[model samples]
Target: MNEFKCKLCDKKIDATPYFEVHEWSYNEHGELLGTSIFYCDICYSKYLYKEI
Candidate 1:
């Protein structure tokens, strides 16, 4: 299987029982302005932690 890369941190995603991926959509006023970005579990958690 191909390894998934995280756009947020540019790291390889490891296979695990709790592994997850994220899709971030770039929108403006309900319009889709850009392509969606993906983040591996690790980076996704860090991103959310920073927002907390």
Candidate 2:
């Protein structure tokens, strides 16, 4: 089996239902750059609950 770790807290993710945090950057010419990070359930929930 493969192992995954949460980017926020570095927690070992051992199951499904985790979240993928994706971001994209666009240039003025409309070119795009993208990245993805993993987040565990607890960290994801806390991230969602934070005040902006």
Candidate 3:
């Protein structure tokens, strides 16, 4: 696990802060590549949809 900061509000938010909609790109082996990270509570509505 790693620490993540909100790109919008500049807040230091970890997984413990509770992000419901976590989006990322991965390889066929299910390894994490990169993420479209957003910090809004209603993150789904805020960030653009990513093609998985």
List pairs with backbone clashes in candidate 3.
none
- Per-residue lDDT of model 1, residues 1-52, tens digit only: 5445555677666453132343445446675443233345665632211110
Best by TM-score, which number?
Answer: 2
lDDT of 1: 0.42
Q: Give the per-residue lDDT digits (tens) of candidate 2, residues 1-52.
A: 6465555676766665444566777869998866444446757732221111
Q: What are the lDDT scores of the predictions, listed in order?
A: 0.42, 0.53, 0.48
Please name the candidate that would achieve the greatest lDDT relative to the true structure.
2
* Model 3, C-alpha of 6: deviation from truth (Å): 0.5
Worst 10 residues of 1 by lDDT: 43-52
Candidate 3 lDDT score relative to the true structure:
0.48
lDDT by residue for model 3 (1-52), tens: 6555555555554553433465666789999865443334534233332333
Model 2: weakest 10-residue lDDT segment is 43-52
| TM-scores for every candidate against the unseen true structure | 0.35, 0.38, 0.32
| Candidate 2 lDDT (Cα, 0 to 1) | 0.53
Q: How many residue pairs collide in each prediction? A: 0, 0, 0
Worst 10-residue lDDT window for candidate 3 reads 43-52
